[model samples]
Target: MMQLSVAIGDYDRNRPLIDGRAKIDGVDPIVMTLTPEEMFFRAMRHEAFDICELSLSSHTLRTARGDAPYIAVPAFVSRAFRHTGIIVRADSGITEPSQLKGRRVGIPEWQLTANVWIRALLQDEYGVAPQDIQWVRGGLEEAGRVEKVKLDLPDGVRIEEIGATDTLRDMLADGRIDAFMGPRAPTTFVPSNKGLRWLFADPTAEAMAYYEKTKIFPIMHVIGIRKALAEQHPWLPMAVYKAFAQSKAIALEHLSETSATKITLPFVEEQLRRAISLMGRDFWPYGVGPNRHVLEYFTASHHRQSLSARMVAIEELFHPSTLETYVI
Candidate 1:
């Protein structure tokens, strides 16, 4: 059996595979549990793992430039609605997305998947074009952060930088910036801070409404295999895909054991029921066919947002071997 190094998050779905409860056929995976930031950075910059959780935006950026180091399988490991991603200063008096016009918004990276979705929704849903606001790029909690992938945005998109030591939380808390948009919320979003709130008053409701309208859950991450390894071992992508799919299935099955809450938070069963009622039994699905609408919407937004050099076809995003699966 070949040993492959893998880097991914410590989510429940991935836990089973990491703990040997699940197995990839014909291969042994040496898994490393890391934060998304560390995983994406290493994967995007160094191709540091045999398989890793890749930022969808960053992956698309590289693929468009024709230098992608990894070949992806359609196992979406991370996804979120992103309505909650837009964090505004309470004192900014920004009541709606429309009010974002002429404001300065801070972001961690232009190549962030959450920002791509947030930016697209702002323009399409509320007419808040990307060029209308001044974009400030910096770290969310520290300093000296740069875009994960280089941006070649078209004209009219004005982006600037923060001070060497400045963070998005500090700028927004003190009102230096009108709002901050990224995958993670600023630490200032607390009762004591009283400075930040999501742009949407009820982000959950807004997300559900958007889902009902567009049927998109907003994919944030994809599993990527080293391109060289994939080319050499043609069966590897599907093997990895099936292992993740099986692990996710196990996690989902665990969600329905209502005798005791499987998760730390309360209302696990209740929320699960609500999600199933709204999104069907297979709400969080994997693979190309199940998530084509989401991929199409995201690819269109990515190109329109100018994060990609060209419009990335869904067909160009995944391994051909994993594109179609045999049905038994």
Candidate 2:
């Protein structure tokens, strides 16, 4: 068995893989639990790990250019609905998505996966196009952040950088930016009482409505294998896919153990039932076949948003070995 380094997040779904309950076949793996920001930066910039959780938007960008350092598997480690990504100044009076037009919106980076999905939501759902608003880019919590990958923006799509010392959290609080949009909410947000709040009065209701309408649970991160490693070891992709699928299956089984809730939060049973009713049994599937619509939709959004060189085909996104499965 070959020894390989794997860098992934510490989410419950991935715990099995991290702790050896699930193992990548034919490989002795060393795992590092890392933040998405750190993992993405190191992987994209330096090829720091043999396997890592990659930002979907960054991967798509490199794939479109035919220069991706990593060949992805269908293992989407992070999935979320981006409705709660946008937060507005409490006094801004922005009650709806449409109201975002002509306002200054702060984003940590334009090329972020969550930002791509949120922008897609605005354009496709509310007819609010990207160019319709002024985009201000800066760090969410700190200052002087930059895009992980260089962007090839479409005409009329522009992003202005904030000062070297400015942070989005501070800007939104001071009303310098009308709102902040990204996967992470600004620290200023306080439910029912706040100087900052979600643009939607009830983000959960909006996200539920969106899922019912579109049938897409936006994918945030994908598991990637170094291009050279996958090319040299032909079996690596399928092994990685199967292992991650097994890890997720374990998590699902644990989630169903309602007598002793595996998750830390309350109402696990109620939430699980609701999710199952909405998305069915294979709710958070990891394979390509079960998630082709999601893949197609995101690729379309990426190309349209000027993040990709072209509309990348879903088939071109993953290795062939991981694409098809033999059913028993």
Candidate 3:
């Protein structure tokens, strides 16, 4: 009976994680609700909770100069998740990356992966550097403060501290900014309500293109374990990953039943079905091998950003050396 404190997003994304089936199937569920910023804070502080699922963008915060030894999970396309995208006002004459020159772009947080990846894409593919565009950070108001995430920004980006999502929405609606960077759900909702057009969406095909070209898997989430504890209980890592994979399989089987039983907000059956289609069986594996592309990308990016001067051996990041690796 492992007392695992696995961090998950808000209620909407966490419903499936806390089901009785998980507990019965061997995951002592202790739930914590926090934004990505807060999770970054907890990881930085090296909180006692075991097994944290954090965004790759927050990996910098987690492994900051003096943090505990933790393994980041590979960035994989979860069975039903999509990459973040840039949303622009439809009629604003901003239809492509080339038009973004001199226009303002908003990011939920400066440290967010979508923001950085999109920045890299803009620079690499379209000859747009950080200096060429107005980068506005939508985050907390206290100077240099976010929930738990800290950002060390490069030059040529502007910062506009916002306290909440509504403030960001107002800003977007008022034309204070030209475009915003965020996950699909958050960015699409407000703009759609206002009939604002999505200038472009980096769909799954685009994600596959980036990977095929760069071999960089945009890490979405990583699960870390305290090094000492992991040494003491070597089996924990595989067990945890196995549990999630199994639970996901169970979730897929009872897609309709799970929705009916839980009735959790916003995660209706239709969404589950879509997620099932998106996160195909291949993306979810019983062991570490399934997310190789994600791991490779993180290793390269970490080195590229000079976040780590040395490349990480993939084996060092996973538990149970014997677990066979596979890619989807």
Candidate 4:
């Protein structure tokens, strides 16, 4: 069996594989549970892992440049609607998305998947273009954050980088930045901090409505295998895909047990039912065909945002072997 080092986030859907309950057919995976920050930086900068959960935006950018180091498998390890990521100062007067024009907004990185989705939605749904805001880039809570990959921003889109002493949380708290957006809420967004609030008062409703119209949950991360390993062992991608699918299945099956909740959340059953009612049984799908629209939209957004030179097709991103599966 080929020994492969894999870097991925620790989530319930991937827990089975991480704990050795679900096994890949022909490979021995040395799973290293790492935060997305560490994993992405290492993978993109150093080719540190044989397999990794890569940011969809960065991966798409690399694919467009024809220099991607990893072949993606259609296993979407992370997906979320990014409406909740946008946080604004209560006094900013940014009650609506349209109000954000010419205002200062801070983000952890320009190429972050969450930021990419948020920017896309702002333009597509509200007609607020990227050039409309002065973007401030820096860490959310800590200091010394930088974009994992170099960016080629479009003209008229101004981006300012914060020094190592600055953070988005402080900037927002001190009224230095008008708003902030990222995957996680900043430390200053708690109830005690009356200064900050979500840009959308009720982000869940906004997200649901957006999903109803666009049918995109916004895929964040894709499972990637080193290109050399994938080329040397063509079957490796399928094996990884099957294992991740099985792991997700196991997690879903456990989540379906309503007698006692598997998760700590009180409304797991209601949330599960709501998800099914809204999207369908396989709402968090893992294959290419089921997710073509999402992939297309994201890649198009990547190109439009100037992160990619051209829009990368869905077929160009994922390994062909994992695109189709037997329906026995």
Candidate 5:
């Protein structure tokens, strides 16, 4: 059985396939799930692993900066999901991106891919350079654990490292921080519970503009195969991609149509139904067509940032086998 590692955080939206579910039909492959942070580091380090899902902004930037080996996922998959947003307390005085100045901001993990992307958004769209804001990073720091990388502060900004989501909620409730950037549900829901509001209901324009200029989207959660492994077993990529495709279809069907069929695990029918209602239609869908905007934005923003990297060609990332099968 071929071995691959995956990273599926708490969010069910992007959870990787597991159990027999992750297996590619007609081929034997075992898949393992890693924490998001670990997956990012391992992929960058180019450690032993067949397929890995990476963060588009933080992980891909490091790869572009020559820190890791080049790994690609199909372009179609990249297009489906793109963009991250900033979350703020409801009563805070911060209204626009400019208001973020001198405020403490909560990030899920410092130096993670999302943080990197948020920084890019601030720079490209908001004109708030990374060197200008206080960044608060979060993680679990209990006994027998290493202290995570604390956020680095720029001039006139202060950063504090805190552990626990409860701390973040408390901070927001007590006005300890001005805003946070994260996945939509957590960022919006948690803050709303504490009387916080999304600072920007729509943060996709800047990202969309970036995509219009460049073809490459900063890749997040890519399932990459090492050159040697792909060479050793040429069909592995196709098999894996197809399995993910099937899983994606299943997820979408679950969202659009309802049944007593008990599709998604642990999440009961009512709960899943509620989640679908909460997310609406565009939140999750099969394939990457929806996220094309993200790549376009990344390419344009990278150009502006002086990265000088070529726009990622669609063919460079995806193989014809998976593309054709899913494209129709």
Candidate 6:
């Protein structure tokens, strides 16, 4: 069996594959657990791993530029609604998304997948376009953060980097920036930093309503394999895809055990039932067809945000081997 290294975040759906309970056919994967920040930087800058979970926005930009070194699989390892990711200062007077116009906003990266979705939502739902606000880019808590890849921002949009001694968290806490957007809540958003509050007081309802209307759960990352490896071993992508699917299947099955809860959360069964009712039994689906609409929408958004020169077709993003498979 061929040996390869895979870098991905540890999550319930991928834990089985990482721990070896689910195996990829004819491949020996040396799994390296890493955070998304380290993993994306290493993969893009150094090609450090043979397989990795890649930011969909970055991957789309690379693909559009015709320089991506990996072929993506249909496995979506991370997905979340980003309405909750937007936070504002309690004194900023930015109570809604529309109020963000002409305000100073902080973001970890302009091309981050989460920020891409959030920007799209702000534009589509609230008529707040990217150029409407001044953007400040910097580290969330620490100084000296930079975008993993170069960006060519659209004309009329103003984005400036924070000073070497400054950070987004500190700036937001001190009212230097009116709002912040990224995947995680800022370190200053805790109770001690009472100045910070979510832009939407209750983002859950907004997220649910967005999902119910658009059917987009917002895919954050996609599985990527080195292009040479995929070319050399034509079957590798399918094997990896099947293994990931099986792992997620096992995780979903475990969630169905109502007799005793495996997680610490209260009312797990009730939450699961509510999710199924809202999104049907296959809420978290894998593969291309089930997620084509989301992919298309994100690609359009990426292009609109000036990350991609043009909209990339979903067919160009995934390997042919993993596109269609027998079911049963």
Off by over 4 Å in 2: none
lDDT of 3 by residue, 1-328 (tens): 6666776554323345656454323457677756655665676566645767665655544444335356644323232223346777665688777898888776666655555566666776668776777767654222343434444445455565554453455566678778777653343356437646555564567666665575454555656666676678766666665555555666555545762555546757665565456555443443446556655665565545444435665665555532464459
State model 5's lDDT.
0.54
* Candidate 6 worst ten-residue window by lDDT: 185-194
In model 4, which regions exceed 4 Å deviation?
none
The TM-score between candidate 3 and the true structure equals 0.71
Give one digit per residue, the lDDT tens place, for model 2 in 1-328: 9999999999989999999999999999999999998999999999999999999999998999898999999999999998889988879989998899999999998989999999989999999999999999989899978888888887998789999999988888788999999988876677755777788988889999999998999999999999999999999999999999999999889889888888788898999999999999888988888889998999999999988978898877788898898899
TM-score of each: 0.98, 0.98, 0.71, 0.98, 0.62, 0.98
lDDT of 1 by residue, 282-327 (tens): 9999999989989998998899888887899997888999999999
Q: Please report the TM-score between candidate 4 and the true structure.
A: 0.98
For model 6, what is the error of residue 47's alpha carbon versus the real structure, in angstroms, after optimal superposition? 0.6
| Candidate 6 local Cα displacement, residue 154, angstroms | 1.2
Task: For residues 1-328, write the lDDT of model 4, one tens digit per residue.
Answer: 8888989899999999999998998888899999999999999989899999999988988888888989899999899999989999999999999999999999999999999899999999999999999999999889999888889998789899998799988999999999998998886678988888999999999999999998998999999999999999898999999999999999999999899999888999999999999999998998998898888888888899999998788889999998899986
Clashes by residue pair, model 2: none
Candidate 1 lDDT = 0.90
Summed over model 3, clashes come to 8
Better of 3 and 5 by TM-score: 3
> Model 3 clash pairs?
37-148, 73-222, 73-223, 79-279, 80-279, 90-197, 289-325, 289-326
Per-residue lDDT value at 306 in model 4: 95
Q: List the residue pairs that clash in candidate 6.
A: none
lDDT of 6: 0.92
- Across 1-328, the per-residue lDDT of candidate 5 in tens digits comes to 5445544343333333554444465555445556665666666565546666655554345444444353555522332223445777778787788888777887655444445556676776678876577776553222122223222233454456675444554565577777777543343355328576667656455454554554334545566666566667667768767766666655566555545653545556665565445544444433446555655565455434433244544444444444445434
Error of 6 at 43 (Å): 0.5
Candidate RMSDs in Å, in order, are 0.9, 1.1, 5.3, 0.9, 6.7, 1.0
Clashes of each: 0, 0, 8, 0, 18, 0
